[model samples]
Target: MIPTVVWGTGNVGRAAIRAVDAHPKLQLAAVLVHQPAKVGRDAGELAGLDRSLGVSATDDVGAVLAAGHRAVVYAASGDVRPDEALADVVRAVRAGAVVVSPALYPLYDHRNAPAEFRDPVRAAVEEGGGSLFASGVDPGWGNDVLPLLVSGLGSVVDGIRCQEIFDYSTYEQEESVRYLVGMGQPMDYVPPMLIESVPTMVWGGQVRMMARALGVELDGIRETLERRPLESTVRTRTMGEFAAGTQGAVRFEVQGIVGGEPRIVIEHVTRIHPSCAPDWPVPPDGSGAHRVIVEGRPRIEVTVEASDEGENRSAGGNATAVGRLVGAIDWLVEAEPGLYDALDVPLRPAVGRLGRNQKEEERA
Candidate 1:
């Protein structure tokens, strides 16, 4: 079994712990949490699992690395501290641990990443003979793998669009939702994520990755954004009140232009309240969905909605993200040391997990 450590206990980290525990080929090593209160706690309890896994949580990064774990699931939040997160990943890679994460955005497409972020990771891989892969839901398989897979069903694909439609009311990140996304803020307040070129900086990699897969060269990339104000005062369970005329919803697209036409696009329609954008696309079943539309002779649209920890779409999305990263650990352990993108990893079936449900049935 591959010895693996989950770093962080937030949204994604919680799912990673449960995933590692359930994986047939992996063994949970030590969980790393920044909060001192979480130290010495059982990994399962930290993950909200009923049973204990015997492994304890620690804040000692040095000791965890020195213990020589085979793989690391770096689930720490990078939205607020991207530089520090990158440094942490570098430290793990240089300690001879193959790492997978969704923290660093620039490195999502390492091939086109800036030299400052790309050079150090390359050097670390060489130094310790380890590998690193960074990916997530929107910028991850939702755009790259899912769309490309659906495109194959079409005889002649003219254009492809990947979309993430969600309501952020249940999303736990308050600062990101209120400030970074401009939700619950005034209409004139510009969210950091929607500023010029910022969308390109984050989701641009998905566009490029799709173009590369389709064997097309993009003439250029472009961004377009739209924000909507709440019609009336709205209150959320966690976040407080969003007064009338405040920013309640946002829609944006990062398009990859090919042959002077926008051939590939990654679009997002996010809202603070479900009622904010009635006309915009929404999940088929619930408040969140990742969708792919292949505009061709026989147009195909696919939607994925996952709910975990009490039907919370945000937690569900994070769980899927953890699934993607943790599932790739075994492959990274066998592959050569280097940096990799979503395309480099193969999506395998749940061969071993198929029987897990049956075993649980017997146990119960």
Candidate 2:
């Protein structure tokens, strides 16, 4: 297996670095970073590992790519800089690196992606002779892989609903929470995430992917949203305070219409405070969870709750997304070069991890 270069040192990038370093087959070749201050830091420090991983972070993208790393975990934040992220992934693939990322939303299900989003990546993959796959928590395994796998357990399937119930207080990205998602915006202000066809553009592909996997034809896609304002001012540990009458909670659904009904759905129930949305769903056992519920026959439901140190729900979700990308490196290396989505990239079996914990114990 070719070593992996982890690009970006954000939430997802940090997880990807740790995942690649700990994997039995993969090695962390380099940590690509944009910040000059992080240029020479050890990979372990960036990823919060106990000891240094020999690889150092670098700002020189080309030099790192040319260093013979066969794969890159492109974990840069896509919410704000999608085009930049896409261009970087394109360059990595063209540089002969198989790329796996959650950055490019359109490529999560490249089959349904618009031409503006899919065409360039397709062409780049064809030219580079390297594979590209994009996925994330909500649009990644939660909706596509988990739901379709659960569908097999049911004798008669009516509707498949995938839900991500999370509290965003610990989520550190301030700009995103305040503006992009409109978490604490005034009630009159429309959150960018729920405005117009944004939800469809972001999540419709997941619905379509699930439908395709279940052999169900979708007639169309629809979206619905609801928001709740804070009864009084409340402060969060990370993103500061929200004044009274501002947006505090939001529930939205991206529905896949089947025979004029919303059959396959990807729904989100998010809040700044746990108390805001009492009626809305919460993770059964923890602060957050990704759940897949089948509405038919036996009525099967599966809930996934992951936790890292400090019980950070956001980190858990980030780790899952990283694993989905890094674990697929072996498969991606052998698959035909092109743009792939979760549907094309099946969930891989657990790669037996060794040598990491023992080292940690020794250091401690």
Candidate 3:
């Protein structure tokens, strides 16, 4: 079994622990946490599992990597500390641990990523003979794999569009939801994410990845943004009341222009309250959906709705991201040492998990 370490214990990291424990071929070596309180805690307990896994959590990243684990799931947040996250992943790679993460946005398309971000990772991979795979829900699969796969259904596809429509009221990341996304901020206050060129910086890789897969050359990339104000104050259990006229909803698109048209688009319709954007597209049943629309002869549209831990879609999205990242570890360990994009990694089937339930029943 491949010995693996999971770093960070937030939304993504928590799910990573559970995923690693359940994987048949991967053994939970150790878990690394940033919080002092989380240190020395059992992996299972940190992940909110019913029972404790033998492994414990630590903060000594250098020592953990030095132990020579075969794989590292870097589940730390990169939004606030991109440079630090990159350095941490580089250290893991240099230690010869195949690293899979959803953190580094720039490295999602390493080939097209800027030299500053790509060079260090490449050097680390070369130095230690390790590999890296970066991915997430929206930039990860919603725009890259899902759209490209769905486009195949059309004989004459004219355009491809991927969307993330979600209500953020249940999302647990209070700082990001309230500050980074400007949920409670006045309309005049610009959220960092909606700043000029930021959308392109974040989601453009997915656009390019899809365009490349479709054998289309993008003329350029473009961005569009629209925000709405709360009609009335609404209180939440986690976050307090969002005052009237505050930023309640945002809709934006990163368009990959092909033939002078926005042929490939990555759109996000995010709302702090469901009632804020009644006109905008919403999930069919719940609070969130990752949708892929192929606008062509057949006009195909597929919606993916996921919920976890008391119908929380944000947690559900994070869990799916963990699934993609963790699921690729075994394959990455056996492959050549280098940075791999989403398209480079095949989404392998759950071969071993097919009979897992039956086996559990037998054991019981």
Candidate 2 is scored at a TM of: 0.95
Clashes of 1: 0
The parts of candidate 1 lying over 4 Å away from their true place are 357-364
Q: Give per-residue lDDT, candidate 3, residue 137.
A: 52
Best by TM-score: 3
Better of 2 and 3 by TM-score: 3
For model 3, where is the 10-residue window of minimal lDDT? Answer: 355-364
Better of 1 and 3 by lDDT: 1
| Candidate 1 overall lDDT versus native | 0.90
Which rank order by lDDT, best down to worst?
1, 3, 2
TM-score of each: 0.96, 0.95, 0.97
lDDT of model 1 at position 117 = 89
Quality of model 3 by C-alpha lDDT: 0.88
**Over 4 Å off in model 2, which ranges?**
354-364
How do the residues 101-150 of candidate 2 rate in per-residue lDDT, one tens digit apiece? 98888777788788987887777777878789888755388978889999
Where does candidate 1 clash, by residue pair? none
Candidate 2 local Cα displacement, residue 209, angstroms: 0.7
Top-lDDT candidate index:
1
